[model samples]
Target: MEIRALVFDVFGTVVDWRSGVAREVRRQLPGVDAEAFADAWRGRYVPSMDRVRRGEQPWTSLDDLHRASLDELLAEFGVPGVPADARAELVLAWHRLTPWPDSVAGLTRLKERYVIASLSNGNVALLVDMAKHGGLPWDTVLSAELFGHYKPDPEVYDGAARLLGLPPERVLMVAAHTSDLAAARARGLRTAYVHRPAEHGPAATPPPGADPEADVSVASLTELATRLSA
Candidate 1:
């Protein structure tokens, strides 16, 4: 089936989360290794979401989860005495993430040909703020918060298609992570893997190139647009 809408995974796929979080961490906590701190915080993302996914906890917004992780990380990193306001500001770092170089222009081009929206684990408010901050031209924002389930869960993928009023196959799930794409595929959505080698940072091992199971794999969103004839 031809894809009519493209729903994106936001954090590592569209935005440079590591750099943005590190920048905020550097500013907020002068003495800490900002990059490492950023990595540590992101490292907790899946586990935190897994809690809610497993029904171990009720639905919690990504922002609240991030805050909870941040508090634990602060103490783990031996950076105590951070005021409540400061912690809150740090949690907002996810909202201020910068887009990758090809993100805006490529998404703009794709938007000209297809409906482009975000289908992310991040809550709707955070997605909106990041879009505004980065000048991302999404047609609409769809998030796990809306479905009360995170990526890798069928509800989020199925919910995106339902909300778009398109069949699962008519929507392409675009992401940097194969796990996300795989889950989308399981729910009958087409998959596109957009390589993001620098998502974790330069020193970290890169994600595998071109997922074998994806309908398409491209180096950047521009490439994806080209491949999709957008």
Candidate 2:
């Protein structure tokens, strides 16, 4: 089936989360190792969401989860005395993430050809703020918060398709993570893997190559736009 809509993963796929978070950390906690702190905070993301997925907690917004993780990290990193206002501002770091170089231009091109939207684990408010901050021209935003389930769960993939009023196969799920794409594929969505080698920072190992199961794989969103003739 021809894809009629493209739903993108936000964090590391569209925005450079590690660098953005590190930048915020550096500003907020002068003596801290910003990069390590950023990595540690992000490292808690999946596990925190997993708690909700497993019914261990009721639906909690990504912002709340991020704040919770930040609180824990402050103590863990020996900076437990951070003022509440400062901590709240730090949690907003995710809302002000910087987009990758190709993100806005590539998405703009894709938007000209198909319905383009965000399908992310981040809450709608966070996604909206990020879009405004980065000048991302999404036709709309869809998020796990809407479905009360995170990526890798069928609900998020299926919910996006349902909300778009398209059959699963008529929507392409774009992401930097194979696990996310694979889950989307399992729910009958087409998949594109966009490589983000610097997502976890330069020292982290990048994806070795394209995902064998992805319908398309490319080095950037611009390449994805080209592959789809957007």
Candidate 3:
């Protein structure tokens, strides 16, 4: 089936979360290794989600998870002079993450051809902020917060299609993370993988046990845009 809508994964696919958060933290707390802090904080994400997935902890929104991780990292690093309100403000940094060089342009091209929306684990407010900050032209923002579920879960993919009034095959899940694409593929959606070689950190490797199979793989969103245009 022809793809009419493209559902993008925001974190590393569209927005450069690692660099974005690091830059913001660096702006606030100068002469510090903000990139290291961003890496450490993001490192906590999966295990934090694991606790909820295993039912060991109550379900929490990504916003809370971002805050919890931020607080832990702040205490661990002994970073000084932080106000209480800044904690909330700092947590919102994820919302305003910067996009890749090609993200806005490539997505703009894609948007001319298809409906574009975010299918991210980020909350709606977070997604909205990222869009505004990064100038992402999205038709809509969809998040796990709305569904009370996260990616790698079939509902997040299938449910999005249901809401968008598109069949699974008519929607394509485009992501930098292949695990995300795998889940979408499981739900009968077309999947495209865009490579963000620096998504983790300068030295970070791809996540362990990622799927080798994807319907499409491209060097960057620009390449994906070009291919889809054809």
Candidate 4:
């Protein structure tokens, strides 16, 4: 099927989550190893969601999970003097992520050829705030919060296709993470991989330039747009 829609994984793909989180952490905790702190916080992400997926916890938004995880991370790091209001505001740092240099231009081009939307584990409100802050040009914001299921879950992928009124094959899932692309492919959506070596940090390794598994793979979203538009 010809692709009619492009659904993106926002964190680390469209936006620089690592740098953004690290920056916020440095601002909030002056003496902290900001990068390490950012990685540790992000490291808890999957486990927190896994609890929900495994039915150990009730359905919850990513924002709520972030807060829950943040409480633990702060305690572990032994950070000092953060009041309740400040803690709450700090958790909203996810809302202030900055977009990659090529993100807006690439998405704008792709938007002309396809219905562009975010298919992320992020809550709808979080995605909305990030979009506004980063100038992301999504046609719609689709989130796991909407379906009560997170990415790598069949429900989230199928739910996005359903909401767009398109068959799974007609919606391309674009992500920097291999597991996300793999999950979308399993749900019958075409897959495009974007390389984001710096997602974790300067030492983070990049994924292969080409993958037999991915229908398409590129160094950046700009390249993805160029190929898709060809």
Best by lDDT: 1
**Candidate 2 CA-lDDT value:** 0.94
- Residue by residue across 31-88, what tens digits does model 3's lDDT show? 6698898888888988887776677888798999988888788889998777778788
lDDT tens digits by residue: candidate 1, 170-229 = 999999999999999999999999999999889999999999999999999999888888
Candidate 2: segments with Cα more than 4 A from true spot: none
Which lDDT value does model 1 have at 63? 97
Clashing pairs in 3: none
* Candidate 1 whole-model C-alpha lDDT, 0 to 1: 0.95
Query: What's the TM-score of each model vs. the native?
Result: 0.99, 0.99, 0.92, 0.97
Task: Candidate 4: list runs displaced more than 4 Å.
Answer: none
Q: Show the lowest summed lDDT stretch of 10 residues, model 4.
A: 203-212
lDDT on C-alpha atoms for all candidate structures: 0.95, 0.94, 0.85, 0.90
For residues 18-120, what per-residue lDDT tens digits would candidate 4 score against the true structure? 8898888888778989899889989999999999999899999988999999889889999867778867876899999999999999999999999999999
Candidate 1 clashing pairs, residues 3+ apart or interchain: none
Model 2 over residues 1-230: C-alpha lDDT tens digits?
88999999999999999989999899999999999999999999999999999999999999999999999999999996799988988999999999999999999999999999999999999999999999999999999999989888999999999999999999999999999998999999999998888888889887746888999999999999999998
lDDT of 4 at 108: 91
